[model samples]
Target: MSPWVADIEAAVDSVLQAYHRPGLPGVSVGVLAQGEVRLRKGYGLADIAGRRPNAPDVPMRIASLSKQFLVTVVLMLEAEGALSIDDDVHRYLPDLPDYGTPVTLRDLMSNQSGVRDFLELRLLCGGNFSDPATADESYALVKSASRLNFRPGTAFAYSNSGFMLLTLIVERLEGRSLESVLQSRLLSPLGMTQTHLARSDIPWLAQRAVPYVVENGCAARGEWSIPLDGAGGMISSIDDLLKWARYVADPASPHAAHFRRMARARPYADGTDSPYGLGFTVMPYRGLDSFGHHGQLPGVFAEIAWFPQIDAALVLLANTTEINPFHLGRRLADALFPAALAPRFPPEVVPPGHYYDPGENRVLRVLRQPDGENYLDSAMTRAPVEWHQAGRFRPYWPMLHLQLAAQDDALVGHDGPRAVAYRRLPTGYAGAPERFTGTFYLPGLESLWRISLHDGQLTLALTGRFGTRHFHLTPLTDEVLIATPAQAPDGHYRPTLRITGAHGQRRLMITTDRTSRLVAGEMLPSTDR
Candidate 1:
């Protein structure tokens, strides 16, 4: 290995060792230079009970990084005249709802397909889909909702549902399961012995590293709602992924030059916004044009970043959600490969406000919430629901938002730039206040919000593994709620909340609370009568 490669490996080990705790479990790292694996290493224990350290050969769920590989297959097939990226999705799956305009494969690849994300709509319906077939139900749900976040070829929003729809198109055109197509084309041809399509019920992988979640000092296996076939769902070992990366990046390797075209960013359909290349995230991260995708499931956090200009890339995979692979890997690259690395984005630089609806902001004013005395003394059912932060719960200010409509009913709201969706329940709580005061768990975070009604107002308590604290909720109007924290000596928490619901179940109830410190004499407005 090159001396720089050795330094890169050592730096990675030091960071992981310094920040990692015993309970957080292990991670795998692979570094690619000039189209080959220059360094591969593993850290901590994969199975803590067995004292088994993570290894390069161990298979891990690549999550969204799998998108790069899936899109590669599509592009290669296109190059072979097997299919066209510009083909309409209805060409294969005619069953998809035709919303007057057709969505193309290119639109899906770039996330410009105006179709609402299936998973976002799925969560809105109180429907659960964990496996492949049932996962398709999310798309059907999106069709039933019949709402589009934007017109096809309009804007850039990361949408998993778009990738999933591409997977369906791949299957229908080839007349083979996405799993079979991948195994035959990518993994098999590349000689990736350890990599394979992930199955939700894979018994062998359970014994490998065991995706885990901790609750009350106990670690248990956790699962995600991602489909197994194509899109962002394949599993692989760091060693295998490194090899696959080499095959794609190597100019002399078969089909290598052809695949590079897929990585190149292109124009959106309307040519109005920056386009997402075939499969990879084609953007300038810190001024360096990088190609990679970030992936997260229930128990895994991953990122694979490749700077094609330098022919250098980094892959980081951790079993714990707390360990953000993307930030860590970027830091490692900066520390180890400074000259070729991308410049850091300044903190104060404002990102373009693409998702903003000025009308919504007109009705909303985000304010900071007061703090609780301690973890135990804090109320759970108040505005600015406590979010898990840096080993403790801190109040977050709700980014107050409003949507104008002729009818007073539930509505759909899209998650900022990520394209996720939430149901906006009608905000008339005076008659049925108790309906909003039950327990609800934040998906993926495992945090809980408990609300209780008393004295004609709502008392909300926020809790997680750390336990419960209280807050006050006073409905200002049919569409607004103001949250006050219990212990207000140092204005530490402010809650602004929006509730979204459908049918008999609440789909998305969000509280954006601002956390602040107490200032002398500003009395905490409490609903604790």
Candidate 2:
């Protein structure tokens, strides 16, 4: 190995050293450079009970990283004159509820379909990931939606429901199971012998790594019973991923054109380019153009990034949720190409306050940590801000960058491809939570929710198939409240409830990171209350 290659391996060790010990579930990392496997190593244990150390060939659930493969299959079918990315999705799945606009395959690929994410819907229905669900149940959950989050192609919102629908379309067109189609078209062709679409109800491979969730320093096995589909359900090892990466990075590969097409950004309705392309996130990291996607499930966290400037690809697959693959991937990239990284300067400090976006009825809080670090706070996440210049900043998350400049007493900027303007709210602005107290019905999912006030605190209760779940509602403004589950199943599922209209005609709009505009109308006073 050359000096640089040695340095990279050492960097990987340093980054993953904490998980290198025994008796803990860990990760498998693969690094490919110039069409060669520079490093393929596994750290920690794959099966703590069996004392099996993780290896490069230990199959693990990759979650949404399966999307790239699904997109590839769609492209292959398109090449065969079976479908077109620009064609309306209803052409293939005509039974789908019409949203009064054409939702094309391109919209689904770029996450602009405005479809509600089925996973979030399941959570909203009081169903956890561990709950047993069949493919039909999953499909029914998505198909029951009466409206789209927004007009198709107008904005971007990540939706697994779109991909699930794509899976149906692919199956309908090919007249075969998605597993069989993927195996015959992509996995088999690339010699990815150990990679295949996993089924939730079947027995796991003996060599597969056991997924674990660490709570209070204790590790427990994670369980998932939702059926596998094209949205996310692939299992593979580092070796197999490396082989796939080599093929993707090869300019002379037969699917080179398709890969390039997938990497190109697709524009929203306003003609502004989106950060996501076909099943891939297109962004620049350290001044290097990159494309990749991250995946997360109950206990799995995975990231696959490809930097064309350095002709390198990095894949990190973890069986435990304790580690963030993006952070590790950034550290590994820094070690491999330190000289290639662009220098970053501290961002110009803005007055810490709550900035509200009127269009989306959302608020962004600029908060200062005790350590003097600044963070951008939202309902579902708190990401540290790393400023690139005076007004431009990039958060410590993928596919997100922003520039906030003061304009007409407002913070005007763009969040990725979406233009946004936020006005600082008056300090101590609190909404009247009592005004929203009542039972509401969502006809889309046939779900009912009750907003109640008890001891000066508001709670939103949702009753569904599993049971009832109560979420603590914290007022953000006179019209918006952040509903946080009293005991979040995954500890990260929160949605914002925005109240609109006048006193007697008020409606609720629920939104999450991956879902938006789930409207619920107030039900008439009845005995059900």
TM-score of each: 0.68, 0.92
After superposing candidate 1 on the true structure, give the runs of residues whose Cα lies further than 4 Å from its correct spot.
1-6, 128-133, 204-207, 214-218, 225-227, 269-275, 342-529
Residue 236, candidate 2: C-alpha displacement in angstroms: 0.6
Write out the backbone clash pairs for model 2.
Answer: none
Best by TM-score: 2
Q: Candidate 2 lDDT, tens digit per residue, 368-421?
A: 888887877665556676665566675555534455675555678886557789
| Candidate 2 ranges with C-alpha deviation above 4 Å | 1-6, 350-355, 365-373, 388-390, 399-411, 423-435, 500-504, 527-529
Tens-place lDDT digits, model 1, residues 1-529:
3324447667676677753456546688888887767678877667777767777887778877888777877887888888888888878777776667777888877666766555534332332234334564555554563445566665555566677777877777789888888889888988998877774554566546766655455566555644455656778888887887777677787777656766676665444325356676654444566766667666676777787777887888776555556557666776656776443322211111111122231122222324322111111212232222222222221111111111122222322232222223333445566655555555332345656798877887655332455668766444345556564211223434445453234432342211111011111124111
* Stretch of 10 with least lDDT, candidate 2: 394-403
Backbone collision tally, model 1: 40
Candidate with top lDDT is: 2
